[model samples]
Target chain A: MTLTTLPPPHHEPVAPHDLRARVTDVLLRFIDDQDQILRDVDPELSTMTTALREFVLSSGKRLRSTFCYWGWRGAGGAPDDEGILVAASALELLQGCALIHDDVMDSSDTRRGLPTMHRRFARWHRLGDLHGSPEEFGTSVAILLGDLCLSWCAQMFDGCGLSEAAISRAKPAFHQMHTELMAGQYLDLLGPARGGGSSERARLIIDYKTARYTVGRPLELGALLADGGPELRARYAAYARPLGEAFQLRDDVLGVFGDTERTGKPAGDDLRAGKHTVMMDLTRSRATAAQRAVLDALFGNPDLDRDGIGKIQDIIRETGALASVNALIEEHRTAALSHLTDSLLETETQATLTELAITVTNRDY
Target chain B: MTLTTLPPPHHEPVAPHDLRARVTDVLLRFIDDQDQILRDVDPELSTMTTALREFVLSSGKRLRSTFCYWGWRGAGGAPDDEGILVAASALELLQGCALIHDDVMDSSDTRRGLPTMHRRFARWHRLGDLHGSPEEFGTSVAILLGDLCLSWCAQMFDGCGLSEAAISRAKPAFHQMHTELMAGQYLDLLGPARGGGSSERARLIIDYKTARYTVGRPLELGALLADGGPELRARYAAYARPLGEAFQLRDDVLGVFGDTERTGKPAGDDLRAGKHTVMMDLTRSRATAAQRAVLDALFGNPDLDRDGIGKIQDIIRETGALASVNALIEEHRTAALSHLTDSLLETETQATLTELAITVTNRDY
Candidate 1:
């Protein structure tokens, strides 16, 4: 079943880079506007806008923006409409909110190759000799900052230059996306403890947390803005879901196998953390009795060292877990791409989306 | 300057209580709707909805909604428009977002006299024997829940059954409230660390964090929905800001002097937290060098004992800080009530607003 549903990432980088650059500019302008509004309240409050600007503009793949843009393009949104670009940029704020909270949830110290917001705030507490536990203070500041991002996401979306009709069309999808994303985050927290680890359960999480959020809804948002009807939305979902899971699976694979320098964290970090990923469940289902014992001993061990990591890596490879995951990736990729066949989307936008699928699934860094 | 601008809460509870009950019912229905939506996504995610319902419905004064409902009434809003009630209920969700984030920021273990959301989530981790740090897990869950509330606040406001014109009128105020509240939170955080602790700085924090957020904008939102003109909005703000600050000042007083059973926390909780407010700044300014030395040693001490709290309390009283704060509250009350004198508000709604001012400032719990 995995064989037919997934496919490998296309190897080379896809270059539809201008739109991404444009989306960044849109975000910067919005932040600058906010800077003025906040400054009027008090000069000190502008620090938040500055932090928000740094968080948003410093780095991002702008994948959702591109997906949203292309979705609009596919639905005959005017390529020259700056309004769509402004509207599409709102997705980044939404993503930023998610990442800020996700890092806090995971107790992650870094993101985008920089200290995560909470870590930075924690450091401030120590350096400033502030009155509170640095960790608690840091967590608090990050939580507030994340909240600011969530609030600003809605502000940006509502204030972005979309026509009333376009906004009306997009509103339900946007609202549903947020509700789903939070629900998905809750479900993810439930996963490791609930301990199903079955591929079916994994797929369900992926659908809510990644696939629909990262791709399907965004694409539908674009289509909705341009008045794309039911059939078009259905097609977008068909193409989005498998590809999104493929993207996540690739991240999981790279977490174990990719070079530490490239992935920005240690190889097998996920193994030490024992992240409730489906790939591992598949491995557990197939592992020999001795391998199962090794897995049980090493997985999620905080003190698991390089040697333990290497051993687990070897078991994963030896057990054909790597091969099967690759098989699953290919199956999803094929399933996603198959929807593009005979699609009514504008040819250029369709091609860009196809390329995005490759870049999303295959990126090593 | 502070003494001339603030006022005391009237001692009796004014009971123009229909709007509050109506608002609660509206919140319950909204939460129920969200419950259904999340359950549709997955059974487990519905737990978030349950938690949210508990948080919102448990114990809030419904101050913002009351202010809003009366603002609408004052602006000739039909006392019967259920839509306005729904729109006003959105404030409680917005308040929910603020309280959850604020509790996390303060690292306070309780809210409305119960374990904070993070505390509750953390307890779940310990009880369920989940695999990570319970505190971290709890904080993360709380942060996500806050984001969910913030999102639903907007969604509810937008989806509330208002005509397009009313929504358009209300949107900017609603949007501004969120932006300013976050900015105020940021300013409040900066106060202790940056340490001017002057009355001016504290007042600025109050204006943004509590004054406008707690009262001003909610009224404006109601007025806007009812097409209250600029004159009416200006009058509303003039009435709101001083009354809002009086409410905050009264809270500061209660935090120090009210019964723990009534206040829902220990006496001097704000002093223990070293919360920067105009009332405290006055104490600092008037304190003798010996008293200053005592304060420097004890304020914000996380391990502050009951003896230390008593010492601080004695100083606050002796320095005449408590007297000046009450004096300021009365001044502001007079200023706020002065607006009602010539106001064109419906007599019934005017009486309600006047009574609300007394209840909000005077509440023991």
Candidate 2:
């Protein structure tokens, strides 16, 4: 079945509000504690660390951590405060580190309604009259700071005090998450360099880079930590796969059409960067000669200005790319919901997860 | 006792020849196996992966892995075929990954008598006629490839089937090693940016970054995994700490005065790059006004010619920096050997490790 056709499960609606709120609260506290540890390490380093923590902890869905928490809960594990929170926090820290490094790699200049970490570091370099060129100093700081976060993430996991058996069982999944993410990143880097590959190849890259790392593996990791058996692991995959796809599909749409004010990025930034998104692949495959000319002229041009971005957006819309992407998002969201029906979770837990799936796909920014 | 005055141990010599040969064989075989897995995943991606594996596995002292193996053996652990080798190999892989990324970050052009990974990728980009600027493409490829190596390192460790008890015991040391390495890296980066901190601060960075991560932690990790108690762990530190300092001191000397033909890197590259070494701290502190002027003119100029590098080297030597650094290296090496006397290890194992320490510090390259 496609993602757009699943029926909603029957359950009282009160459970999700409480669970999501609890998860959000725990996440905030986790970030604060980690920030304190970072500060204690080196006061001078704290400014960048605090900024990075704030950027990541700023308002967002926190969906991955929630999924991990619920996955643990669904596997019949008790909510031991330290274990669950540490596990979830570790995931968040990993994500934070990834996003900061990804931004610098992508040359993104803004995030979450503020200057991106690299850009801020550049500003600080100028103000402080640091020894190196401002840009080099900025990039260096970002790299080191990201490395710090990555190291801290591992430390948190090691110190989490989880049962040895549980940690060992979950360890492979964690390693896979990192390896797969890097593989996905490599594919993404290679995609544009190689020009165009098969539609299937492009889709595979998207699935690996975003879908699998963002949702599938996280859910699996949580379940594994909770000692969930293979059946439960299999059951979670059904929900995770479609949810992941829908999530990426929505991101692609936002890349093309979302407002900068709401998204906290330049409009059509992805187009300017020549990201090899699924939407771009579909448009390239199906566009007319005139549309192709538009792409050829503007795609990957470093000098593409505001007017150029506008024209590219117009072409995307006129070619019906936006509608098709929206349709895919809906399709995957429905498919993800359908998977929940077959899952052997508590009714209340299943309902909360289902609602989460809907909110995730429908997110505006 | 101070690190410079310890007495050497009197022990029967144990042949490390067998252990070294066996460990090297296992490491190469495992690397080849991992390469096969990469090829299976996607033959197209194997080009970069193959080059990376070959480049890293080519030739090195394998000092870290050797320490790990010896630590395990010294702790009375039996030499298992796959277990110790796998764990040691994982550490080696991690070291390789760090080196690859660190080389790029430092903008070095060569390693081990070959083009650095970034330069290699740049050449590939030119040959392949990839889309963007070849330099940018090369940088992107190296970055992603380094990330892949890091991920693979973690994966190798995850697959290592150490008993939960052993891993749990060893895990803290593992995490601290990473943390200290990164912290040391941060200090190194900051040293140049801040135009050289106090001499003591510079020494601390070298100790933490090079000495601890390279030697001390590797030995401790292996010992911990073998279920060594606190007394045993303390004994490794007694040997490892001074040896690590000597190792860094030797590296500092090599950075300034090593032969380019043997080192692969250009002689005095560190001086030309204005690396904030402890030697630099000493030189700057002791230089006459004319010498200080010369240093200020050439330091970090990025346009320093061969003559300029030679002049800087002369200044360092004339200022007594070279002699001081040499004396420090000898002092630390002597201290390290002295500590071997205190280790509660088998006579043969103590002799082997002591010999290994001498080999590490006295290497010409």
* TM-scores for the candidates: 0.95, 0.90
Which candidate number has the best lDDT? 1
Locate the minimum summed-lDDT window of 10 residues in model 2 chain B: B1-10
Candidate 2: where are CA atoms >4 Å away?
Answer: A1-48, A79-81, B1-41
In angstroms, the error of model 1 at A30 is: 1.0
For model 1, residues B34-147, the per-residue Cα lDDT tens digits are 898778767777778888888877765888888888889999999899899898999888899898888877778887679999999999888988777788778778888889
Which residue pairs in candidate 2 have backbone atoms (N, alpha carbon, C) closer than 3 angstroms, thus clashing? A3-A331, A3-A334, A3-A335, B7-B338
Instruction: Note the DockQ of each predicted structure.
Output: 0.65, 0.52
Predictions in order: lDDT: 0.81, 0.72
The candidates' interface RMSDs, in order, read 1.6, 2.0
A1-365 per-residue lDDT for model 2 (tens digits): 21223344334332245555655565556556655754565555556556655665574656666777778878877865568657766776667667777777777787877777778888887897778777766766676666656656666665666777787788878876776676677677777777776767767766777667877877787899889999888888887887788888877777666667757778767877787777787788778999899899997777788899878877777777767887888898888888788548877568767877776676552
List, residue by residue over A1-365, the lDDT tens digit for candidate 1.
22223445544445356777788888888889889988887887776777777887766577777788888888888988988787788888889889888888888887757888889888978898876577877777777788877877777777777777788779889999998898888888877765555677677888988898889988999898888888888999999999989988988888877767667766666887888777788788889999999999998887899899888888887888878888888789888988887858778877877777767776662
Worst 10 residues of 1 chain B by lDDT: B1-10
- Model 2 lDDT tens row, B47-78: 76677667665646677777887888788878
lDDT of 1 at A320: 89
